[model samples]
Target: MKTDILKFQNLNPEKETQISNLFKQLGGEKKQIPLKEVLEEGNHITLAYCEHNDQVVGIASMCAYHVISGKKGWIEDVVVDEQFRGQGIGRKLMEKLLEEGKKKKLTEILLFTEAHRIPAIKLYGDLGFKLKESRIYTLKMP
Candidate 1:
């Protein structure tokens, strides 16, 4: 599989559409967000892969933030097409994110996967992430 990492600015219309379609196929309620939102947010990066036939087989995103200790990034929305899993595409996406974070001088990159997502957890650990012993709390708004 041919894979490449592209910044939002470098994404063409076809690639953008591919990304939107991929998100929906992965069960995202929404299709696509405006490019302006991505840029204005200033910390999020989207990575995509294109196969030889020009189909996007994978997509991943990360949001970076600054804290007192240092800059940190959070991985989000990682998805590989069901047909394309187990080909190392997901790992490539993560490698791209890590490289981007390093380029931006981030001190850490964090991610969370559900307990049932054992494959994802293993992938993260193989990429040098450790499971935090601390508890996580969430508050949903109406």
Candidate 2:
């Protein structure tokens, strides 16, 4: 398996379709950030994934920003194709994302996983992430 951070310019219609399908596997439908924005926006955004024989099998994204404290990064949409799970594909994608974050000189990286996603939680722990003692709240705007 090969993993790399994807450049927005490298995305094509086919790749967009493939990645959209991958997000569907993770239960996200029509929720992916536009590939154009991912490419045209500031360098703080990173999109990493694993591919085998040119087919993307896993993906993760990191978005970073600077504040008074320092540069902070957030990981999102981490998912491995259901058929490709348990083979370390997700780990590879995450490692690539982390590498990108470090390259950007982020002071911290954070992520949110469903409480029921025990395996993912363990993976984050093994990767040296500690649970933050704060409540997570979300508001949906229509």
Score every model by TM-score. 0.82, 0.93
Once fitted onto the true fold, the runs of candidate 2 whose alpha carbons sit more than 4 angstroms away are: 28-30
For residues 8-69, could you state the per-residue lDDT of candidate 2 as single tens digits?
76889988878888988877434767778776766667889888888889989898999899
> lDDT of all predictions, in order shown?
0.77, 0.86
lDDT of 1 by residue, 6-107 (tens): 665666788777777777766735456765466453546655454547888888888888899889998877888888888888898888888889888999
Q: Give candidate 2's TM-score.
A: 0.93
Q: In model 2, how large is the Cα lDDT of residue 95?
A: 89
Model 1 reaches what TM-score against the true structure?
Answer: 0.82
As a whole number from 0 to 100, the lDDT of residue 125 in candidate 2 is 95
Model 1 worst lDDT run, 10 consecutive residues: 39-48
lDDT of 1: 0.77
Highest TM-score against the true fold, candidate = 2
